[model samples]
Target: EAGVVQSPRYKIIEKKQPVAFWCNPISGHNTLYWYRQNLGQGPELLIRYENEEAVDDSQLPKDRFSAERLKGVDSTLKIQPAELGDSAVYLCASSQLGAGGYNEQFFGPGTRLTVL
Candidate 1:
C-alpha cells in the first residue's frame, strides 16, 4: 500500500531563499513527473522522467529550478532564490505504465510552499 511520498507538506521561505522538495514514487513504477499548481489553476507539467531519463522538461524553468531522478525511483526538485510567484503546490506522481500510462499518474497530496 505504497503511494507517492513527499516531504515537508508545507514550507515557508523568503522571496529569494532556496527551497527543495523530495518525492518517492510507488515501487516498480518507472515513470515520474513533477507538476506545479497555481492557485485556482490546473497543474502544469514541469518535468517528466522515464527510467532515469528526463523525457520532457520544456516547461521547467531552468534558471531557478532543477530536478533529477537518479534511479528513476525517488526524485527531488529544487528552487534557487524562490520567488513569491513560486508559492504553489509541487506535486509528484508515478505509475507502472511508463510509456502508455498517461492517466496512471498517482499524485501525492503535494508540498504547499509559501514564499514571502
Candidate 2:
C-alpha cells in the first residue's frame, strides 16, 4: 500500500564522482520508471521497466549511466563520473498496468543531486 520509496533524498558530490540512487516501487505494481528533471523543466523519462525487463531506455546515457531492476521489485540508477550538468532531481514512479495498458503513476519524493 506504500507509494514509491527512495533513499538519500539529497546528495552532493564533486564533479566526476559517481552517484547512485535507489527506488522501491509500490507492492503489486508491475511498471517502474526513473526520470530526471532539470531546473524549470519537466521530468524526462530516463528508463522504464515492466517487471524485470527494461522496456524503454532511449533517454538514458549509456556511457556513464546504468540502471537495473532486480527481482522486478526494486531498482537502482547509477551515474559514474557525474558531471555538473547532471545536477538535477531524480524521480522514481510506479503504476499497476491495468486493462488496455491504463495506469496511473505514483511518484516518490525525488532525490536532489547536486554536482559541485
lDDT of 1 by residue, 1-116 (tens): 87899998999998999999999998988888999999999999999988899889999999999998887788999999899999999999887755534557789989999999
TM-score of every model?
A: 0.95, 0.95
Q: Model 2, which residues run further than 4 Å from truth?
A: 98-101
Lowest lDDT sum, 10 consecutive residues, model 2, at 96-105
Query: What C-alpha lDDT values do all the predictions have?
Result: 0.91, 0.93
Question: 113 in model 1: Cα distance from truth in Å?
Answer: 0.6
Cα lDDT over the full model 2: 0.93
Candidate 1 global TM-score? 0.95
lDDT of 1 at 103: 55
Residue clash pairs of candidate 2: none
